[model samples]
Target: MAFPRSTCLLLLLASFLLTPLEGHTFNVMDYGAIGNGRTDDSEAFMKAWSDVCKASASPTFLVPGDRRFLINPVVFEGRCRSKKIKFKVDGTITAPSEPSKWKCINKQCHSWISFKHVDGLVISGSGTIDGNAEKWWKQGRVTGARPNALVVARSNNVQLHDLSFKDNPHMHVVFHHCDGVKISHISIDAPEDSPNTDGIHLKETASVIIEHCTIGTGDDCISLVDGSTHIDMRHIKCGPGHGISIGSLGKFGLSETVEYIHVKDAQFTGTTNGVRIKTWQGGRGHARNMIFEKIRSSDSEYPIIIDQFYCDHTECHDKPNAVEIRNISYIDVKGTSKKETAVKIACSDTVPCRDIFIQNINLIYDQSGKQASAYCKNVINGYYHGVVRPNISCLQNDKLP
Candidate 1:
């Protein structure tokens, strides 16, 4: 009843001809130890990187241990793309207090670690990259030229794991114009008082996943800026920072449509706010299909918020910025806060915020709840439960002076 071998040749060939996966393995070595927590091991780190992730070599890179490393931001130029570029750092990479004194990539961004115009690079380590950012952060109060810890730009298929990056003068990690990024099992810590020290800044990216991470800083644990889509975050712990956020968008002539995003199984402690979606009245874009589920918070500000007229600065921008936010659902969110209200929904006038839903949220907003000062148009189908008050008080309760 079956065909003979020669007769079924084409079918057999088809079965054997599935698309093969092209991937490479590389390694890096800091030539640095992990215990001391202070050393300049970047040069050796670069040497280890050069040995492994060469132009024609395998993609995965490993970083071995047993020494001290003081490294500056390694410079990577040109359009570098291969199966994958992996950095296995089992040691420590230390950033100097003065970045200018350290080895720099292009002199534009002072990062302890950086990559530019790369494709499919996976940077992971069971070790630590120490920013030691307190002095720099304190100096930034006067200079205001603080630098980020890790910077990746114009890349794709990026993965970071088993890594601890901390003490950033500015943002701890930044992904710019990079798509397909994944961050897992990473820990970031900075002073809760540091300014602009965001945990992760994902800008102009598509299809990003942040999971199993613990972040504590001064700004948003995750800040999604202009031109991002398909972002998924889960199983995260954040504290003393702005919670996971979407937009202060549409300021730079950008109109992003964020969808298919989910944030769940997250816990927050003593953060300024919990979950927020903020947009300016001047941005022109649409946001749909966002879900926040199974998130818990304690001693937090606004547990849920949607601010369409969001501008923290006075001279905001001169753009036709507006956003259409709809079809957003926040379910199974429980939190205990002493704020005035648990939810705040402030939309824009030209384009309203509608179809926002909240169910099974057990938020405890006391009279001391915080609210946003930014005001805009009214929202439709905006729902809430266990929230005290809104549209009356700005974010004065948690406002820092």
Candidate 2:
């Protein structure tokens, strides 16, 4: 049974080549993370993420279940060795309950947890992300000072689903300056009186898809601001919030453009507004080629509206310039309105809305036993198709520049 030394070496090499390497799991607990809710596990999380990013094969950064990890503000850096990196949060990740424990630079921390430059990232699990923002909300200051829960910026091909985000100080999840994003089966919630708690906010992002989400918050369930295009949303349930909005854009006299947006099969209940598009004066650019279809609203105020004169402040100086809105269509919108004006299209007098189409709309004011009506101002070249209730009498087909 004597074999040559070269033959034995060759056999060993073949065995090594055929064997598969198992994927790594970098658990935060293994990196000195205290699973207790009070301990600061920020450094342990960063350490775990560092190893996960440096791993050559598919690796998972796991926050296992049955424990609460208190982590402060941290950013997970990207450009990882493996593109298919998984951030599996099976346990709860909580923010510092008090402002004193929060780490801020110059008294400002914009986001609690941020993911930057991470491409092909997948964040999924049945765990909760608790902002622990009760003290912050009690301050009752309405400024851009509060920190959002989770933010993913400058990334591509990101997927987030099966997560629960609750009681965030401000917006729950924000995707900024990203492309090819998918969010589904996620739950976001906060108290109705919580200020600026938007469910999902997108800015400077494109090629996004949001579906099968249940969101109830103080602000818009989903808001798409400047430079967002090619967005598709469907099967969403929004309530106790400002209904899905597309704007507050062109603020600060900035030029912004949003186009090719589609929202379908959304259900809104007890929301402030159903489908809204608002813009500020003294700004340039246009919002065009948008479609809102198959929306059902119940006891909502302003089921369909387009306010180019959207001024949130008390003293907003009126300017001559305005954001142009064109080629917007609303189809099959059936709703029960809480207010008398079910559909309000208050466009700018200078730059009127063009090619605005409303079709198959049936909205009624069943709350106060009054009639629901339509209000339109500075709107031109509008078209009304099949069964538009409350009859938009102000629509003028005359082309005026």
Candidate 3:
């Protein structure tokens, strides 16, 4: 008996255009952020990431939990308006423990928390990003150029999980040119003589999916340089790091490229190199389809390397076109080698190393009964199947020049 009045304002504008529109947290202590671990919350996290990147719904940028901010070289910019931006971080994100209180940005000191051009980003909670890098590692590892602790540039579908990284003044979480990334259960620690502390690095990233990580760094617990491709790592737990590398790629000679990499169920203890692939000498391109399966190496030290003459110094000269390694595989790698060789395929005497595959390798020699060996130079098309224990004999005669 009382309808009219423009039919009750057209039923309240169709119930406010079918509801659903509230999700824009943006709390960095309400934009003035005084989480206190020595103050500088970087302009309250860039004004709460500018209202969580201008929120258009799926927003959230919080940083709550047991406080400890103090960030300095920040950057969090993005072409956002929210396509799912959640960066929660339960709290603790230090850095700037002196190397002159570190702050460079344009004059370089590269990354101390940068996530530019984000897309569908989602960094998880139970945080801890620390990097109070012990005075930049006593300042002098080539003058400690420092600063790399979280940098996800040109992002795509990124998603990092349950974070925790520490004492890193160099590489600890870097994913450049990202696309479809997903890092899981993260945990990285430094100080095994922390210098380049790389825990999880990847350049020109694509379709990445790292899982259950637990890295202990001093370098590469997982590094895939140059245009990294479809990478997939599993249950990793590397140690005093250096295991898991794929190219010190095409360095002074550029033209690099890394291919579909897959590492499985990894676990390396005192690592120094357990599954490597360091390229150097006048680089060219191509690090083909790779896979290092079910690896478990304790007391590692070159438990299976493929150094394309990766000279870290001594005025590296000998250049003759390297970086062409082909379809590589090393399945079920079991080990305990503090070095008695333990499989070192130093390929590239003019780009050698084609199909190189080795099956169930069991390396020994961690003292108690010495026995572990296998070293091949310029690997020329190798392939050995089934039980290969200290017996790679140049990959068993699959010779191809």
Per-residue C-alpha lDDT of model 3 across residues 1-401, encoded as one tens digit per residue? 99999999999998866643448588899888899799788888998888778767788888998999988888888898768889988999897688677667776787888988989999999989998888788775666477888999988998999989999788989988888999999899998888888899899989999999999988888999999999999998999888889979988898899999999989899988888988897889989999989898988988788888887777888888887989898888886889888788878767788888888788897856677888786666678877788887777734434
Of the pair 2 and 3, which is ahead by lDDT? 2
| Every candidate's lDDT | 0.71, 0.91, 0.86
Candidate 3 residue spans exceeding 4 A from truth: 1-25, 39-57, 62-85, 88-92, 95-121, 124-128, 131-158, 161-192, 195-216, 223-241, 245-271, 274-342, 345-394, 399-401
The sequence of per-residue lDDT tens digits that candidate 1 reaches over residues 1-401 is 99898879978777656523234343333344233436555555556555444444335555556644566667654364345566677776677777446555455545557787767677887777777677776556565356678889888888888898878768888998888999999999988888888898887788899999999998999888767778899999999898888877765556666666789898888887788888776677777789999989887777777887678887765344487898888778776764655666777665767766665556655434443222324666655443323332322222223
Q: Candidate 2 lDDT, tens digit per residue, 193-266?
A: 99999999999999999999999999999999999999999999999899999998889999998899999999
Give residue 148's error in model 2 in angstroms: 1.0
lDDT (0-100) at residue 384 of candidate 3?
80
Where does candidate 1 stray beyond 4 Å?
1-40, 55-60, 78-82, 103-106, 141-144, 252-257, 314-321, 366-377, 383-401
Candidate 1 is scored at a TM of: 0.79
The number of the candidate with the highest TM-score is 2
**TM-score for all predictions?**
0.79, 0.93, 0.36
Residue 323, model 1: lDDT of 79
Q: Which ten-residue region of model 1 has the weakest summed lDDT?
A: 392-401
Candidate 3 at residue 287, lDDT? 91
TM-score of 3: 0.36
